[model samples]
Target: MTSQGLHLIRGVSHAVFRGQHDDRAEECSFRFWRCGKGFEISVDGRDVNHTEFHLLWHQLVDDNSLQNLSRFDKWFRLWSEWKTLRDVLHCPTYTLKLAKTGTDMRVAAHLVAGPVDKPAYDMLPVHVSDMDNFAKGLPVCGSESVRPGSWLGHSPGPVRGPDGRLYTLVLCEHRALDAQRGEADMPSWDRIRAYVHLAHSGVDTHCIPRLSSLVTDGGLVAGVLIDHIDSGSSVQGLVEAAVSAEQLLSLEHKLALWRDRITLTVTTLHEHGITLTTPEYGSTIHELNIEVNQHDQVCMLLSFGTVSIVVGQAELEHKTSDMDELRTVFDERLPELIVETRRRLAAA
Candidate 1:
């Protein structure tokens, strides 16, 4: 659907985010399309302007056009697109109101349940099929799939950052998740989790990963930030924690910590021999990165041991992997982090 064509579903998104967003962001988006114009709703909610959204949207719609904005100024351009879309359509701002179900989640149940007759599954052409060859002509590093600095398990598909860099959105790990409730094409929790696990923690001979683990095992995915309560918390605990963060932190702080924690955590997880390249469990495991543009609220991502620094426009991911015994090293990483925090807090 063309950007201007999105006006048809502007009201549906308005209705969905307002009443049903609480039930499920994905579902609301899904069902909103049952009203029949999905591409329109997504284009509108993504709210990027016609020209800019067109640049990114075109990449998504054409499987052969996916460009890594990291190679260009994508992160920034995404921000511009969102702003333009919002102003042009005048969408009511997307806000988060707390719920009892999770630390962080985008799908809601009730709104999705009501009148949600099945909308035929029409997957957003999120990937640019074999776009790699075509992308080489562009200025950015042309890769088939972007080697994300950090894999944040948010939702499936893609996210165009404020910078204009196109990010494949792998939503936070799902705990007792159900995506069928909505109208649009939202991936199952398992699909998303599989993607994260395979994408970031790829084929490792020693680590026998299981897709079932993402669904039922004590395995948890923190959908948003890393706060004190969630530092040692289980993945199941993260859902509520994420909701609280929306209530607690400002937009800018949230975005910063999202990038910070994921960058730090994924670098640490790699030592276990996970390359995030396999398919069996591609997008299942990940620490998500959420960046809010708002100012005021402040928070710190739980960067236990690793410290990240930006060398220039590019952020260098650095860590110490010289440890001989991997198990012994990971075992102590979190324990020592807790002790250190206590000491620092006491000294303060």
Candidate 2:
């Protein structure tokens, strides 16, 4: 049991963690309940003649630390022991039930799912080309023809290009692009060209998605097609999952590496006179993607969206503030974000 899980159990007047026990003979439900100063554990199935249950019962009975312990201490001991048993037995799913003291209060049930499966996509080849030729000869596809995938909501989805290679299209709203052009006095296509040029010019092109071609609809630039990331999660999603599972401490080193990768990538972009636009501020996490392998190695990738070429002093100041906010998020504000996520989970 984690400290956060123990805290939750202590705060609630009554709580229970229930799940199915691993049994080949018969399906059974095992429950652990914490009520006031006492606890109750039960197992129900068609066939209850298993030795595993008896073994667990005997193990708990033989444990002297659980005897004469305070309410919180005893519950903690029991939870830790049960969790060990559960993991060894391969019981994956659990439901946590929490209730207040008042009879009028309803018991809140939260189903804690097992390990999450990474997002899946069809394995496809990526088409890479120079930005100038790619943009010039790019085909215009109707927005209605493209279907969104699980990759990044409705914006980017895997699409086969003219060369029959798979790529993801990031559609830009024409109105928004025009607004940016009016503000910056630079065409949207020019900004994208400069951004892609800088990304390709870097020694580490792995962190940036490869631009293949631009997609357009009715003369307006709809989006650009970039290489598809095989198995990736948004940076925001990764952080939220770590916070939810209370694994932040164990994975802190990995997270730090990811942050550094992102910082280095952005710094490289800034050095090339490319900075994120004003609208992209405070939401840099969503623009970043990461893939972790079985060996625990991480590959970071940047999804280009709403970037501008730094032309003057105003743009330089904008870039400075953006970098500052990026540092603040990964460095100073991460703890607060984790706490806030925990609070939301508890409230829910």
Candidate 3:
């Protein structure tokens, strides 16, 4: 239902906003699509202003507005209700504008919703000594053993610290800054700091990696220091190995235990207002550590970037439902994967 000439960003398609049957064309309130490098949008066929569109985008996605409804539906309801009343009174229709500056789009919507001012990401500066100390005398922010380096494929680097504990430094990526800055697909370093702040204020710390310190340079966030999670092994590896033996009963038991643990993990996350995306859970289960902490074994959810703070129970339920669906797919596939593994193993 998108109007012609609307250029969508890399990872998104017009079909997302347009309902299956084109029922959402006019009914939708806003049209802000995520682009690979920036956003391409058309708000009511009017020239979209930078500031208002930015505010409106955040208002739409952040406040649990994108939970159950499609983007179009959510924005439409809000705009329609407000517009109907405003139009009847013969008021001018305010537009959401997008200002593009060298790959950065700045939109202000303070007049309609969200914070009165944009957040300025200022924090402590990151020093060479800090990186060296955290990395146990290793190099900072690049590839080398025993050093702090960027993790492969869109992740921060994990480093060994002087305290004999592992740490990871999450910094701002160029794409996230100059491109998708402010979109929920990739959180700003400041927002990550906010999540850390929330965690420090008495959320369940055991379920997540321990955040150690904030790394910055020149008053801007350079990176975040998170405790590196150590694992005896991963749940996925264990499950897959068990499945390779073709022991149905064992596989079933493993699957059951995984179901329980995953449920518990999801519960703990919800209790603290956190939700994990699909890549952070199902596909990345191999990254989750099952390690012994003190006298007991614990599960550490890795990759904070894949998580988000939900608005309410509704959003939480929606997120939890997605996790559960992924679990179901894994459960159904295990039997077949087990058979495949067993055949290959036997042949070997």
Candidate 4:
């Protein structure tokens, strides 16, 4: 989307503060813009010295102190602390309220002084399209129809799309892009597109999260929306619970079933010319999600993690290595977990 398109979706307002700091009169004004769940605040005084404010802001960000404080408290400290900005008036308190317009939400800032409550100030809503300038020029397949929605919770969680389906937005990691490489040549995009291909390759998608759409901003690929998997339903959680309960026989039987399903999933991916990249930790079993049917039988083995497309003959080694590592997990890790659980039980 262009800047003009962004302005169509934004709301703007201004506010001024006047007070005395250390027996000296002070005054400052600020411009606030609110757009698509983002807020931008800018100081608007012409002759005001903002050296102290900039230094204090950098200090808070460097030590990560601002992250520990609430959003309102962060703004409050930045605006009200005289040591941070002497030219700015110290406002004692403030109130924040949210107003909803259809599916979109807007925030209103109100300054409170003693017994008086000032009218809520409107802020310009900055366009969400400006968030990812680095990914500009990367081709996005069918991204024109994909509408990014507000994050459901913390990032990497499900985001409700315009289609009303829950999707996990996987942002392209910065490290995946090489400095000398063009954005279109990034391996991350290739991996993402490979997954999208696998989703529609007529294989059983029950064991994998299907790629719904690619998220883009300003014609650049920013991220992808994939089917959301509940982390609570992972096979690791089930195995740990079975070990704690000392259901050795049942645990072994369930693991056998899961192993077979995983084997089939790996085979399917290999056939599609995709390689399951072994994570840095080397355990793929933790990424397996399980869903049981009404008859209490394991129904699905949802694979959730990183994967890459097999390009060269040398990259084919990943296929065999992935299978071998999974086998080791089932053969060694499962028994070790059982032994540890029993030892702890006996000691207790």
RMSD of each: 21.4, 19.3, 16.6, 15.0
Backbone clash count for every predicted candidate, in the order shown? 74, 0, 17, 8
Best-performing candidate as measured by lDDT: 2
Each model's TM-score? 0.20, 0.46, 0.44, 0.51
Q: Is candidate 1 or 3 superior in lDDT?
A: 3
Candidate 2 per-residue lDDT, tens place, 1-348, comes to 101112233354222322233433133333433321222223333223334443443333232323232244433333322221112112223343322224443323334442322111111112235434544534445433443321222344565555656677654422232444454323344345553565456445445566666554434445567776665455445556764445655555676876677677777777777665465322333324455544554444333334566678967876886687676667666656666666776776
Residue ranges of candidate 3 with Cα displaced over 4 Å? 1-154, 162-165, 175-185, 188-198, 240-252, 278-305, 312-317, 346-348
Q: What are the per-residue Cα lDDT tens digits for candidate 4 across 113-221?
A: 2322211121111123553442234333333343333221122445555566666655443233334443323344445556556655657744556666666543445
lDDT order of candidates, best first?
A: 2, 4, 3, 1
Q: Once superposed on the true structure, which residue ranges of model 2 sit more than 4 Å away at CA?
A: 1-153, 177-191, 199-203, 215-222, 243-246, 277-305, 340-348
Ranking by TM-score: 4, 2, 3, 1
Distance from true location, Cα of 155 in model 1, Å: 2.9
- For model 1, residues 1-348, the per-residue Cα lDDT tens digits are 111111123223211211122212222221222122222232222333323333543443442333332343322222222222112111222223222233333322222122222211221122324434422232221121222232211233333333455443322322322345434322333233333333344343121211211111012221111011112333222322343334323322443444444444445445432222122222322222121223322222221112222233222222222122222222453335434544554565
Cα error, candidate 1, residue 32 (Å) = 3.5
How many clashing pairs does model 3 include?
A: 17
Write model 3 residue lDDT over 168-221, tens digit each, in one string.
655553333333244434444433543464445645555456566654443334
Candidates' lDDT values, in order? 0.27, 0.45, 0.41, 0.43
